[model samples]
Every structure is written in C-alpha cells, then in structure tokens.
Target: MNGAVVEARNLTKRYRDVLALDDVSIRLSADRIYGLLGRNGAGKTTLMSVLTAQAFATSGDALVFGEEAYENDRVLSRVCFIRESQKYPDDFTAFHAFKAARLLFRNWDQAFAERLIGDFGLPVKRRIKKLSRGQLSAVGVIIGLASRAELTFFDEPYLGLDAVARQLFYDRLLEDFTDSPRTVVLSSHLIDEVANLLDHVIVIDQGRILIDAESDALRGSAATVVGPAPKVNEFVTGMKVLHREALGPLASVTVDETLSAAQRTGAARLGLEVAPVSLQQLVIRKTLINHPSRRVPGGDAELDSMEATR
Candidate 1:
C-alpha cells in the first residue's frame, strides 16, 4: 500500500449557497494520529465525509490507499468511521450490534470488544435506543476500537462521557496504538484533553485550512507575553498579535510568531513573563477572532470543532 493513506486534491463541496469546503487539499500518512480541528461550518465534516466515501464532493477527488474511496470495496473495507450519533436498529442490542460488526470487519477482535463492553459497563441485552447519550457513545467507541481497521476515524466519540470514562478511552486508545499502529484521526472539542494524543493537527477556518503541522511545532509556534501595558505593547509592536488581554496596567498578548534567541533575551530584559499557548486556546482565538463574521453553526465552537472533524 502507498505511504500516503488519505489524499485530497482540490476538494470542494457546496450546499446551496454555502460553500462547505473550498478547494482544500491535504495528505495524511499511515500509522500516525491526526487531530482534525476547526470551528463549526468550517467544512471539517464535509472533508472527512468525502475522504471516507460517506458523502461525495461537489468537485475534486479524494483517495484512500491510492484508490477512489467512493463505493470502492477495496478501500472502504479497511476504514471505519464512528459518528457521534451512531445509529443502530431500535431493537438491536449491543450484543447483536457486535455480532454484525464481527461479520463485517475482517479484523474484528471479539475478545477486545467484549472487554471494552465490560469496562464501559454497557449491558449486552440493552437495546441501543434505551441507552443514554453517554452509553450510546460508548457503543461507538467499542466498535471503532475493536474493528481494528487500518484507517479509523472517531468523530467526537465522547459526548456526555464523564471525565473518568473519557480518560479510560484515551488510555486504551494510546495503549492499543502503541501495540498496533494505524492511521487514527480524532475529531474532538476537548482540545486540551486530546492534545497530547495527536502527532499532527490540521485546523480549518471558513472552509480553508489555516494550520497543518506537527503538534509540537504548533505548540512552539506561538507564545504569550505579559507585563505592564506599555512594555508589553512595545515588545509586541511589530509581531503578529493573535489576541490580547488587559487588566489595568497588566497586559497579556498572544503572538503567532515564534520567538528567537534575541527576542527571548529581550523579553527577559524587559521583565516580561513569557508562556506557551494551549492548543485549545490558540484554536479558539484563531477561529473566533479571525472569523468573527461567521458564527459557528453550533452555539459551542469547541463542540463544533470536534463534530465537524468527525
């Protein structure tokens, strides 16, 4: 198989007057974890749908394993997409769903699926329709993990899950990833929660890719400095200030530009406190500040970011 697992070439999608995606192109490799991030209506969902063959693009092409993904059995069989609101027949119990999954997925691990079901405290006989939102999410998680597909996408898989349950999911995912590496794309609103799990991140805004880089590199790309208003203002005068906050004499400003050795020394000399910006905060500022004219479809921008990526 080719090293490039997912490839999009000038991908575009439209819904009536709205351009859901706009000439977006990206290349994702295998055996790595990717974070698909963007505000609501930024085309994150449209892009993933096109790549996974769940939905067609209005223009351009998407390839999975070097083959057209749309209705292509060769490519589709190796992929699994777990939607946030995954649907199961009203009468279908978790046990029945797993049985179906076992028949469909060549790599399905029944033992693993059973263990996950126990860990999540999901009742085998309970019909899917009777499960709570959190339990419903757990079913999707179990299927996605146990399917063992070479390419798996988890689109906001932890909705309504408590902190403890969410942590368990992350722990299991990381452990399994270490044992058997595959391409895993996670779309989540809890940026800080999954920040450490991602090797790479792709951020989209207004249907355009705004940032695509290694997670570590992105973390180091921006810095925030705080000090007296005048000094901070002087220090950030020519830099790309992404956001700024002021409380009387104290001022804190986040800059998009990386700091040089000379700049670091200058900040120290000026008695300015420099700190790193979290992925979540950076994304919020980027999407909200840069595109204020566009309100995220969902009231919650973070939730939209996670779901859109799915």
Candidate 2:
C-alpha cells in the first residue's frame, strides 16, 4: 500500500453463510476518481464499509493512507464515508449535520457547504427526519462535496435525487475535483450516469472482482459485429463473444476485444458493421455473460429485472 490512498489485501467478509467480499484485493492511487460499480448485492457496500472501518473484514487487511483504518484517528479524519441511508439524530437539522461534519473533517469548507445548500434548495432548518427523500439525499451530497476529505467514499449518494439534481452533483463534483484533486471512490448502480466522471473502474460481481481497468481503456475494449450470420460468426470466431442476438439471417455479436484498424477494414470488406460498445452495455453484458443463471432461457428477462432494480 506504499503510494496508494486505499488498498485492500485479500479482504474477505463472511456472515455465517453469506460471503460479502471474497478474497478481494485492490489498490487505489491518490487524486483520482474511481467508480466501484456492481449490481444490487455485489459487495460494493461491504467493501467500502470495511475500508472505512465501519465494519471489520473477516480476514485480511484494509488500509487507508498507508495505514490500517480501524481506530486510526489520523487516517479516519481525512476520510469521509457518505452512505445512502445516512442517519442523524432525531433533533438534528441539516445545519447540525454540517456543524458535526465541520468538526469531524479538518478540511471542511463551511462557505462551500452554504453555497451547496442554496444550490440544492435544501431546507437547512428542517429536521433530518422531516426532510423529504430528495432533500435527505441532497444533505448527504452537500456534506460529501464540502467535506473536502483526502479520501472520500460516496456510496449511492444520489439515492433519491432526480435526473437534474444528479447532474448538478456530477457537475459540482468534477468542477471541485479539478480545482482540488482527492481520492474519490464512488459506488453506484447507475453506471451510465457516473461513467464519464471516473478515471478508473472496478466492477464487482458475486463478491469477486469481475473487471478492473482504466476507464479510458474500457471505453472501446469491446465491439459489436453485425452482418449475415455466417460472416459475423467468422469475424468473432477467435474473440471472446460476450453476447449474441439473431434476427432472421442477421447476427449481432458482441466481442470482448479491441479490434485493430485492419480488422475494422476487413469487417467492412466482409459487409459487416462494427459498432463501439458503450460502458453501460459492456458492463451489463459482462455481468450477465459471466452469470448465465441470471438470464432467461431464451431472452433477457433477468437483464430487464436487473435494469429495473437499478
């Protein structure tokens, strides 16, 4: 964990029969935004919880700032963990939450917090229990941005935010991050929304790391080949086919390989259309392809189920 802001070595978390994190190891460098993405119960929350010391790993190490995070004031003070269902005292208001955060996080910016409150139209005087779902999420977003912690973990920080509010969060996050870079680990089910904000991505599935690579590298790492069934199948013969759909004689096959310029020209010559796979599409295909039980017998009924949950 020498130069890493956060690192986990063979981390495992098991609750009797359920294994949340299965021998997971990862290294997160400093001053970069990372997307910790997965489906509904894919150990994203468990990983963050262990890293922040909110929950202990059943085995192995969880380090932050080059030291074990549990009960380490020097490490914990520079870290902020804003969970989806963050709780506050019944009597506490948004103002009180900010006050507490300011005292907890040494780099807290009160002025920025005030500006965010106004931007979100949050009712600072309203009690935490009295605020609407969207307002509650806004409170968390404000604290996460204004805290300015060196290591921040935002676990579904846009839980109740609408499309507009979510966009505002992304805009502010990128703007502030450009001015003052920090290590940010964002775990969200909305992969497409936060895809552009991430420098690196670590996708988890069934308590294991499915894909961990730079975001730029992953963008065009896969391609879809479409043409007559025979030629399309031949084009993707040696490639790792992620998915395949057939409509009469036409076959569109998604392959997990970066095609060369010559390959693209060859496909065109063979009357095949090559299209770049989107980040969202790639993630879904990889996840579903790796787990066939989640798919319906002949269609994507379970894929639809997964998307609905997201």
Candidate 3:
C-alpha cells in the first residue's frame, strides 16, 4: 500500500466482434501478492497483456511503474510475465532458457534458479520440445521465481503440474516471497488453493471488475445456513442472500452478510447449521449471480425461481 506499482484507468479493449475488456479500473501495490481471478474468456489475459505492453487497449490507459510499459526497457526489465503456454525454440533446453533469463533480468539469481531446477526435478539437458507438459510448466515457474523481478505476473503458472508439484510451487513461492517481498499478480482457476497466498483479490467477469477487495476482509463475509425451509427462510429474511436451494423440506441458504456470535447462537437454537463459505464458493456465487448465461442447467436462476413461488 506504499505506492501503486501498476494502475489502469477506465481501460477498455475491443476486438471487432468481441469486447474483451470493458471500462475496468484497478491498482496494484508494491510488495504484495494479488490474485487476479476469473473464468475463461473473462478478460484476465487481455488485462494482463495490456498492462505488460504486449497488447494495446482500444481505449484508456495502462501504467506500470508510473509510466507506460510499452518499449520502456527500464520498466520491462524490472517485470516478469509468465504465460500459461510459454513457447521456446525447438532446439533450446531448460539450460538455455535459464542462461538467457540470467542475462536479461538484472535481479536474476543463478543460485536460486539452480535450487528451483532441483526442486522441480527439471531436466536441463532435455530439449524444450522433448519435455512433458508438467516439466515445461516447471521451467516457467522456476524462471518466474528466480527472476526476482520487482513486479511479476503469473497467468496460470501451474498448468500441467500434478497436485504435488502444484503444491510444491505454492510452497516455494510463499517461501521465496516471504524472504524477498515483491509484487505478484497470479491468475489461476484454482481459487481455494491460492486463496491464502493472496493479500488482495480481484475477480473479473464478462470483461468487468466484479470484485476488488482485501483478502482478509472477504473472509467470513458470507455464511451458509442449513435447516428446514421455513426456519432457514425466516433466519435469512432481512439479510442479503446470495444463493439458496431447497432439498425437500431442508433449505440451505447462503447469505452475503457475516453473522455475529449471538446470531450464530440464535441459529443453533433454531437447529440451523451455520457454515463458513470458502473463497471458491463465494467467487462462484458472485460470478454466477453476475452472469446468468454461464450457469448450469439447474443453477441459481432456476433455484431462485422456485424459491419465489414459495
């Protein structure tokens, strides 16, 4: 929160028949990890591209390090952008990639890179084309971590890595970040996995910024209460309900507001089960509420319609 490392004001991007980004404004502070979350085609990649100077926005401005990022060596050198599908020369190997990164990034650490190579069990001699998808992803993850850039953007860095490898990446990232605090913006579909790693969260939906808030503030912001339909309905009567469903006589309702200690006790008295909503659940609820077309066959819309009749 000391100063904004990245800032976009009323940003908009359109591609002929498609509107990729729409009037989005956001700011990223230094020395913090931000979770840039959204479903596929939600404009996450488009926004990152615009900010990194890889893609031009049809309208508005994208500023990095207090200046436009395009063609600015001073700015770009201090930043690292790792894409989900990073391509390399067919003849090149992980060794060549690391060697090139060392020269390009001023803050690149060879020792750190070597350690990460070992940690990921990456084969340096194997040609880039000969490596598996998981191994290729490992190369990118290693570079992103070892680059030690002042600002880093990891757009789905854990693409083909298995569960253990993904967790390893998270562990290594958190450990390294704690030692050398820098700004990191991670865009991943696995919300719950990275939820704890984020200091701030930004959720995009349909080219719009649906959520931009401190991560801690979002915890306990919503709760799910389960009980008989009548009791559940009465308990959530004056609250902002994000989602609700009925299974025969039992109704489970998710309210957007937090519950106090007394309120929790009151729910228990009514035999209502109160559960904390995870980050994933909250994001899903919000996204579905915003985009009706993206819902499943028997999703929120149908459930709400059924509730209306009751």
Candidate 4:
C-alpha cells in the first residue's frame, strides 16, 4: 500500500459564524494527481489553508510528511500553493516571481519554467500587477509545475483563461507530471475538464467529506437512467436513487449504485437508456440531493456570487 503524504484527522475550522471545516479526516497517497472538488463555501479552500499552514485549525490534526505543518519551514518550503489571487509584490515581474520560486523551492527547475513561459507567452518583463488575469494565472501555473514541490495545491487557478489557454495548461501539467511524479491536489469548478487527469477524487460539501475514493471506482459507482417515468421507476429497484427529473412523461434519474448485469439486461429489455454517469454529473447530482431546495439556476458559480469564498 502507498504511504500517506498528507493526512488530517478530525480537522475543523471556524470563522466567526461560519464553520468552515467540519470534523473531517482524509489522506492523499504520495505521487498522484488528486481532485479536490466541492461547491462554493464547501470548505475546499479552508482545508487546503489548514494543510498548507496559511490558516490554523480549530481542532484535530493536520500533518504533512508525518509532521505538523504550521510554522514548519522544512515542510512549508517543499509545498507550493497557487490560488486564483496569489499575491506578488508590486515591483515583481513574471521573471521575478520565477526567480523567487527558484530560490525557495529545493526542486525548482529553471529550464522547465523558462519553457513554460514561452508556452504561455507570459511577459517576463511586465509587472505582475499589469498582466491580464489569464496571464497572471499562467504565471502561477508555471510556478506550480516548475517548482516540482513534493506537494502542490492549485485552487481554481484558471479564473479568466479561455478554453484554448486552459487546455494548454492542462496539457503542459499532464506532460510535466508524467515526467516528474508528485502529489498534486487541484480544485476546480470545471469538473469535466480535469476529471481525466485525476487519479483520486475527494468531494467536500457543506464543510464535510461527501465522497473520497479512487476516480476509477467513483466513475463506476453510479449511473443515469432516462426513459418513461413508469418504466424507469420499475427498472430501478433495490438501488438508491440520487436524483430525478421529469420532462412530460419522460424521466431522467440517477441511481447511487452500479448497474448489475441483470439490471442492465432488464433496463435494455424495457427500452430504457442506461448511461454511465460522468464525474461532473455525479458531483452535481450529489450536491443537489444534499441540498434539495437550493438550486443553481445556471452552472456558473461566478455568476451566482462574485465575492470570493473565505
């Protein structure tokens, strides 16, 4: 079995009235790409902050490399956290940021960073504050990849990037990760885009752990069924249903169990449509089931609230 590179036990955080993190325990196996997913205010950022020592835990423990992470220079230097709004000095340019990272990170690769700068077309001479949002994000992505830290956390790093730019980031990260294997935890709202890159998936909802399992196992855990309401209902029995929607007589429902061979045969015989639930669909349906009344009119989180979650 793989050893835990990151571990937390009964971790909780409170910010005034907001209970940011509930009593949550989780572990990330070393040298793997893990997806940290959740809705806004799901404590995803809070959990990362506690693990990275940027914030304190109200209770329980957070350990990195079998040691407490807070104020621990040895552990801190080996970790890199690049969020959407990572701070840089007013005088700092993209090159300056890379230089700072090279000095701080023990495993920094200057050549890799330089190549990424070219790939992203980042203005090395331009001040960090002057770069566009996507360009600024590219700077962070370059650092996160080239730093080659033992543990890296990227919390929604592509805030204003277009599809082409986002795909470039994904491509470069995937390629670099294969060459330099390390533990990475990426948090993103574009679940489908990064789903393929994840070896493990951990979902947090309402300050609590909702789903934590191997990505392969999670993909096979649930399925969606679309057909007539009566037939879909009759075909799905002895299975936990996660969510359901009705369009006239036609119905669409997601079930919380893999389709057995017999179940698949039955569904096919009954002229029902049985499809595998995607990682994004599974997460969305689960979140909806968890909060029945709170509906997201659109899938975009930025549209709902421009304010950043603390």
Candidate-wise lDDT, in order: 0.86, 0.90, 0.92, 0.88
Q: How far does residue 55 in candidate 2 sit from its true spot (Å)? A: 0.3
lDDT of 1 by residue, 1-310 (tens): 4399998899889888988888999999999999999876787777778889988889988889999987778888899999878888879999898999888788898989989998999988989899899999999999999998899999889998999999999999998889879999998889999999999999988788888889999887889999997898888876766777888889888888789989989999999999989999888877775575644455444533442232
Clashes within 3 Å, all models in order: 0, 0, 0, 0
- Cα lDDT tens digits, model 4, 171-222, are 9889988898889999999999999999999999989998898999998799
Among the numbered candidates, top lDDT falls to: 3
| TM-score for each candidate, following the candidate numbering | 0.92, 0.93, 0.94, 0.92
Candidate 1 least-lDDT 10 residues = 301-310
Per-residue lDDT tens digits for candidate 2, residues 1-310, read: 2268987899999988999999999999999999999998999999999999999999989778889888999999999999999999999999999999999999999999999999999999989999999999999999999999999999999978999999999999999999989989999889899999999999999899999999999988999999998898877766767788889999888888899999999999999999999888999998987685755565554544343232
Report model 2's TM-score to 2 decimal places.
Answer: 0.93
For residues 1-310, write the lDDT of model 3, one tens digit per residue: 5699999999999999898999999999999999999999999999989999999999999889999999999999999999888889889999999999999899999999999899889999999999999999999999999999999999999988999999999999999999999999999999999999999999999899999999999999999999999999888876767888889999999988879999999999999999999999999999887776655468755655555446
Ranking by lDDT: 3, 2, 4, 1
**True-structure RMSD, every candidate:** 6.5, 5.2, 2.9, 6.8
Q: 1 or 3, which is superior by TM-score?
A: 3
